[model samples]
Structure formats: structure tokens, C-alpha cells
Target: MKRITTDELRAMAGREGLIIQGCGGDLTELVNGINDMLTQEGILQNGDAFKDVSVFEYDGCTNLLFSMENVDLNIGKLAMWRLQSHETFGGTWLSDYLPNRLGVDMDQPPAQKEKPDCALIGQDGNIFNLIGIASRTLKENGLGEQAKEMRERIIASGSYDKALCIIGEYVNITSAEDAQEQDCGFEMGQSY
Candidate 1:
């Protein structure tokens, strides 16, 4: 999770916040190597480069904290990109950040499906019971996968309103009276 991001650099906005970690070795050697790298990259030369950057032992590891005021952020980014590849440089588990961990293609739109009816009003308001009704409705409509997804999201939703909303996402919520009305087309109040 250790990555020097472009946005982070901007947020710092020319302040003191860059740090480079050293793998177990001579701390002095690690510091010298970094200077050599910056010089090789044509970013900065040795001697004066380490003036603002401090090397010290921290939590059983040597860390180089760079005071960002003296260092150009763009040049620092270039240096960081190069440093990330070093076997004994940066910190543990450094890699590019990804927003969606589910591997789902966020670009594609969800398929349009006609939501089936589920009677929730005046029915058992218990969350589990409501979930059962919603799941059954979806399954009856031949949407077994959506039913499963709804179950997972509803249970982990962490609140009643959230769970109800999840059920509503997959099915049409109806009152008990409306369900009965849909079952029969005759007018309930009629005089002949």
C-alpha cells in the first residue's frame, strides 16, 4: 500500500512529507545509493541533495525523510517511480492503486430486468422474513443470481433501511392489500 501518488504530491503542495524506507543493511549505504540514483536520473547530484533529507533509524529500519520544500515534486515523482522498482528500496507492498477490487467491469451498465412483486407492507417486518420474500420473488422470476446477490447485500447492509433498499433494488415492494387487489380484478366496493 506504499505508493507516492500524484494527488498526494499535490495535496502536500510543496510541504514537508516524503519518506523513503531502507531494507535491512547499512543505513549509510542506502542513503548513498539514493543520491547516486537521483544523480543518474539527472534530477539532482550528490552532497547537497541529502542536505534537506534526513536518515535515521526507525522501528528497527532505516528511513530517509525528505523535507519536500527543497525538493521539486515533479522531480521527486520521477525519482519515486524509479525507486519503487529497487529490490531493497521504498516500503513493503508498493504497487499501483485500483479502486474496484471486485474485478467487475464498472464501464458496462447493469442489465434491465422487470422487477417481480414482493408484499412487504403489513407483512412480517422482520429483516430476515422480508429478505426471504424478496429472494423468493426474484427466484420465481428466474433471477436466481440476483436473489443471491440481494441476500448478500441485504445481510451485510448494516441497517434496516439499507436492507430494505437492497431488496427494493431487485423487486417491486407492495402492500398486502395491493397484492390482493392485483390477484383479483373485481371492484371490492360494488352494489348491483
Candidate 2:
């Protein structure tokens, strides 16, 4: 298998309209996961492995995107695996099991019962996006109040960067309304 640099990954993200954040890891595991899915489906010759993986930097975080062309499966299991493995929440054994258990043939045309092409990942790895696991962590660590305050602060900041900083630090605040106002140039709901 070959490895591609973060810059290459970023270029692909630009072309594909995907946003990636946070530090990137070896990505080999993610690649392998996809290869496994593809092998099981008999898309390529069995035992074929990923040839390239890459990461990119965006905003304040790094993003990863890779391609394993000539993949046997119809829709591309590597893409599916990367999405499932990287998402911050809702990726359970059931989620993984259901796709394989249903035995939907990748080569066959889409059927009513077949799983759809999809990719699921967290928006910011924040509590709101990961309520199930984050809530439990907050409760267990006695951070309920802190978590609530941080949420408010983030909403109030109206500055994506500020909110991201606070969320990154897991900081607490009284209210988002109290955050100092700043002109982010873009109107509300505008993409950054």
C-alpha cells in the first residue's frame, strides 16, 4: 500500500466538497477496513489491498481522504468503511452488522431492501453531535453543568472559531448570548 500526503487529501476534499477537521491518524486501519468489506463482496481479486491514503488540512484541523480505484464492489466499500469508522457517534455493532447481515449484493442493482449509499460523520465532534456518548461522559465526570454552560456559550459566540475553541477545550460558560459579538463577514447560515 502507498501513502499520500495531507496536501493531496485536501485537494480531493476541495474537488468533492467535503470538510475535514482534527488530527489524522495512520488511516491504514481505515483503509484496511474498506478493503475487508470489498474483499467480502468479491469486487476485486480477493486479498487486494488499499494502494494509497492521504490527509489534508482545512480551517484549523486536518482532513483525510483516500481513493482505492479498481475496487471490486459496485459502490465502494472503502468509502463506506472510512465514513463508518471515523464518525464520532452512532456507529455501533448493529450499524456495522446490519449491512453485512442483510447480505445485500454490491454487484446487483439497488433493491428496495438493499442498503443505500451513505456517509455519516460528526459535524465537529461536539457534544451536540455526539449526544449519546458525550452525555454519558459528561454525567460520569460530573461535568453536566459545565457541558450545559459550554453549549450556551458556543451558541452565543456566533463566531464559529470561538465556539470551536471552547468546544475543543470543553470549557464552560453562562450563556452564548453573553459572548462578545464579532463580525464573521458571512451571514448566518452561510458556509465558512
Candidate 3:
């Protein structure tokens, strides 16, 4: 993990060969997440000198490229996916990716005319899985080869899809509960 400035990221995009693309929300959040991870790892120094990270909109999402040298691609991918998921899930044409596994209609027709809330492009190639990162993190933190094996089991069991379904259910339940709470408050006020 290494904290890189916007200029450094751009230069890396130019030189090495890693690509990071995000659609919707603030790109600074993504940069900060990476920087924070790096900083936690003691790879980044404290100060404004390294805070120049930024992302430029390209195609539909903001794209930033960097080198993958000494970087864990799995963690990076998960971080991006989780962030975008938080931002765009439940929006039109931006439903959870996991529901697709359950034969749910997650994809919109090209002629439908609604833009997705978020889209991600990975230059390292499209084997997107946040679980992969979790597995890798486990291994990195001392689970060793067993961590890798468990990650494979998760992928095989379609944990990613199940995770998405669970997340959607949680969000729906939470929203409903919040609405009920608000209605209850309103009724109490009226009674008073």
C-alpha cells in the first residue's frame, strides 16, 4: 500500500499500467480510501504534500490509473466495489449485482434510456469479487493457504450473490423500519 498524489497516479497511469474507473460520487473518497489504507500500512507520510489525489471523468465514470506493483489488486477491487455499491445500489439500473445470480432482472435494456448509478472498470481485467479481497486479506493477516481455500469455497458457494441478496434485504428492512418510526412519531405529535 502506498499513498500516491493525483499527479503520481496520473504519471503511473502513463508509465506503469493500472486502471481505476468509477462512476458517480466523489472520486476523492476513493483516493482517500486508498491513501488511508496505505497510511495505515506506514507506506504514506502524513501531510498535505500527498493529498493531491484526484480523478478525471472518462466515458461514464471517473478513471484513474496506477501501477499494481506491490499492491493487492483484490483489496483494491473490493474497496472500489463496496464504495460504489454504497453509493448506487437500489437506484434505477443500479441494483445489487448478486441478485443476478438468483435469476433476477438486474440489467436494463440498452434502449431503456436510464443511466446506471455507477459502473466500474478494472484495467487488470474483469474478475470482480469483493470476497476475493476478503480472502486475500485473511491470508495476508495470517490465515495462510487456508484463507485461499476458504475464498474458493465462498466463490463456489456463490457467497457474493448471497451477500448481495442479504444486503438488499437489510436495506429494504431498514428503510421500512425507518418509515414506520417516522410515521409513529408523526402520529404521536398529532395525538399531543
Candidate 4:
């Protein structure tokens, strides 16, 4: 799959387009999820608004994006949704084409830039299985396509360490010992 370069993403900022976060699953399912999310939030009343949105891979993140060339959408509502939900499933828009109706800057990054953490220790020692686990985690969190790309990149990685490095780019790795400690506590606390 072709990767969207950061430069290309920067160029997109001027267009009246959007890059929504927290979208995952199969392409079709993700699109549905996007529509559901928007509809639940009362951003839109219909599901067809996101039919043209596609999975856009940028900066190791899988985002649902509406590029300039994409079918026209209610970008005004989407921009407001991004601002209103700044604390949840946060997203940003390409500001160059933005109408500035919200009075907030779209080019600025959020308060936090932390990547989500994925437990790595105590996982299957095999690289492929590790990739599967990481991919599943990502998918559950709305990064389905990023997970696919991570899997492919890890497979092509020359060594296990290199694969781990690639994985780290997408998520923070929790140590095995820490996982074991937590699991031990959970087991001890179990009533059964």
C-alpha cells in the first residue's frame, strides 16, 4: 500500500478537508463507525456523509480522511465536531481552507502527543504473532490500517529488534515484567 507522506499531509492542510482520529476496523466497518460516531454526537443525521471517506495513513496513524478531491461533505459540521470533541477522539483539520468559523486554530497540536501504549512482554515470542497482537490492539483502538502497515513493515524488517523499533513508532511498549506483575495481582485478587 502506498503511504501518504507527511509533506503531502501538510499540503492538505489548506484544503477544506478533515482527518478524524479513533477510526478502525475494516474499511467498510470503519466508515460505518465514523458515521455512527458523528450521528451519535448529532453532528450529522445521515450515514451517507462518510461514504467517500477513506483510510488515510499518516505519521504511523490510521485516520479517516476526506481529501480535497473527495466528494463534498459537511466539513463545517465536522470541524465543529473536532473542536467540541477535543477531549475525546480528538482530530484536526487542514486549516488553509478552513473557514475559521470556530475561532480556534486547526494547525496547533493538541495538549498531549502521547501515543497509546501496547503491552509487549509475555506475548508470543514469535515475531509474526507479536505483530498480530499489536495489530489487533491497534484495530480495537481505531487504527486498523496502521496495524496492517505495521505488520507489513515488521515482516520486512531485517531483524526482531528492527521490528520492535517499528512497533514502537506506532505504540508505546509495556515491559513483560510489568505485565506479569499486573497479571499476578489480578490473579491473586480473583475470587475464584
Candidate 5:
């Protein structure tokens, strides 16, 4: 994936006819909190740089738009989200684009199967097994190709709603017991 800056992102939005100013899930809130924290810590003196910025986040992708004066503030916010525990499933968009804007070089992609950054974790701590919902989320986010891949995986997994699909992979349908017998260290958890 290519990395881009807020300025570059703005240009891309213009070229793609996308809305540059929008709301990303929790991105606005998190930016606000970080700005407030920075102000209190005496790291920022000219009010908050991100106060007037616009955000666009969805389906693990996040984008921001702010003035040059607050570039550092925006960079700080990106750092927090990109390098912190906020990226539970590695589904955040910070490292991919924002850091590149700040001249930061990120590591290369992993050699293993690249897991999808998004997942549906139920309130009961069970990862959702509903391929339909997953497919819909990807499709609605303009990731129609990813949605098709998800369906293919579901079909490959026998489309068993009760089957365990780890990291969104379509592989052997070995149960926890079977894994244990084979010493694969796999365990099944409750799903809601």
C-alpha cells in the first residue's frame, strides 16, 4: 500500500471526488483527547492544532485534514493510534498514511498471511462468525473485492456458521480437540 500525507490525501480526495471533510469512528474523539492532553502537558501552546481538522474514518481506514500550523499535533495523534494498544487487530490506518506524511518509515508487511484488520467481536468476547455481516461491512466500505474474497473463504470453510475461521483464513476444519490431539495448540472459544 502506498503512504500519503494529509496534503496528499486532500489532493487524492479532490481527484477521487471524495469528501475531504468527514467523521471517522472515534477518530475525532481520540484526536480531541490527545490534543487536550498535549495542551495540559505544555507540549502545545497555540491552543490545539487538530481542533479545526476534519476526519474521515471507516472500516479500519482513517484520514485527517488540518492546517499546517497543527501538523505536529496531527502527527502526534497519528503516532498514538498507530503505535499504541488502540490497534487491537492491526485494523488502524495511521501507520499506512499519516506517518509517511511525517517522514516516518514503517516496517515492511509481514511474510505470513496478512490478516484483515477488522473483525466483529461480540460483547461476550466472542469473535463473530457471520460471513454475511463481514462481507457487507467490506462491501459497504467500497471494498467489494474484499467482500468477494470473504465469501469465497466462507464457502471454502463449508459456510458453517459454527466453524472456526482464524484470522479470516479458509483452512483445515480441525476442531480444538483435533488440534490438541495433533498438538497444534489450537483451542476453540465460545462465540455469540
Candidate 6:
């Protein structure tokens, strides 16, 4: 329930991370579409249309000031992807893609499953939910090798919950190459 200033956010990010502005999905595209529609209807000037009115993040979580006015504008999700990675292509989360590829419905209430975004993986501790979903998706989609490896790592940790949190917080395996390059290891107590 704590909020940090933009200065704190900047300090946390430094120069090594990216702050993606939108969900990069239909929700964000809908905002752009609405802006275009408003412009065409003469409600908004051509140059005054919303470019990227996205949700903002404070310390990698969605800053919840939700409203009809701000919903479509402000940074939706925030994460630190690896340097030199393409923002849109590389920053996509596994939960975001699992719905479409696996025909899993994500429209259910948050109580059913955590929303793909980390901000919603909230105080109740739903990181394990995310890891379970991702683990299933990986196995279902023929990434059994990776799934097996992930399972082994989680089991070896001797604390399933902590292992899940570690993966949820530190792992960034957005792609196969990312998994190869960013192997699941962390120096204990390291911020990144």
C-alpha cells in the first residue's frame, strides 16, 4: 500500500531497464482506435488524439488510479527486460500469450486466476498461480524439456513457494533464446 515518486521509479530503473507504456494488446490498441475514431468525429483534433495514454507503474506494479478517463491512458504493465531486447517483441509475458495460443479464457475475475500482469499478482501471493499456469502451458505446447527443468529447479529449492516467487520475480524467459541466455539463477539478495 506504499507509493513511490517518479524519482524513486527512475532511480530503481536507472539506465539498464525499459518501462513499457502499455499492455501492447487489444486494450491498448483499443485506446488508439478510440482516439482515431474521436478525431474522425471532430471531437478531437488530428494532432490532439491520444498517442499513448498508458498506465504508469510504481516499482513494477500498476499504479491503480483506475477510471474511465485514465483506464485507456497510462502505463498498464511495467517490467525490466534485458538490455538490447526489442520492447514489444521481447517484453511480452507468458500469461499474456497463453490465453490466445492455448485457448484459455482470461476474462474471468481475478479471483479465478491472477491477471497476466504482475501488478495483479498481489499481496495474497499468486506468483505460484502464474508459475503453475506457465508450467502447464510450456508442457502442453511441447516445451517439455524446459518444463522439466523448471519443475526440477522448483522442487530442488525445498520451498515450493519461494521457488515460485524467485521465478516470478527474477526470471525473464520471454523467448527460447532468453531462457538460454538468462538461465534461472540469482545472486541471493540482489535487487535485480
Angstrom error at residue 99, model 1? 37
What TM-score, to 2 decimals, does candidate 2 have?
0.28
Question: Per-residue lDDT tens digits of candidate 1, residues 1-192?
Answer: 122333332222223334566555665676577667665666663434544444445446555555533444355555565556645555321121111212333344434567888889898899999989888887555465688899998878899999988888899898888888778865567435
* Candidate with the larger lDDT of 1 and 6: 1
lDDT of 3 by residue, 1-192 (tens): 233343223222112232344534555666666556555555444432133233444335455433333344354544454455544431111122113212333343312212111111222222345444444444333232344555455456655556434323212222334445475787333665
TM-score of each: 0.40, 0.28, 0.23, 0.38, 0.26, 0.22
lDDT of 4 by residue, 1-192 (tens): 123544344433334456666555675765666667877776665444554354556446676665433243455776787788766655666563232422334565423324556788777878888787788777555455578789888888879999989998988888666667576776444664
- Number of clashing residue pairs in every model? 0, 5, 0, 2, 1, 7
Task: Single out the weakest 10-residue window by summed lDDT for candidate 4.
Answer: 96-105
Query: Local error of candidate 3 at 162, Å?
Result: 68
Question: Candidate 6 clashing pairs?
Answer: 53-73, 53-74, 54-74, 54-75, 55-74, 55-75, 56-75
Per the 3 Å backbone cut-off, how many clashing residue pairs does candidate 6 have? 7
TM-score for candidate 6, please give it: 0.22
Ranking by TM-score: 1, 4, 2, 5, 3, 6
Candidate 2 clashes between residue pairs 3 or more apart in a chain or in different chains: 6-55, 43-72, 44-72, 152-176, 156-176
lDDT of 5 by residue, 34-134 (tens): 56755665545557444434455533456554333223444454445435534342423433443343443344331232333343443132333455555
Candidate 2, residue 123: Cα displacement in angstroms equals 51
Identify the superior model by TM-score, candidate 2 or candidate 4: 4
Q: Candidate 1 or 2, higher TM-score? A: 1
Candidate 5, residue 52: lDDT: 39
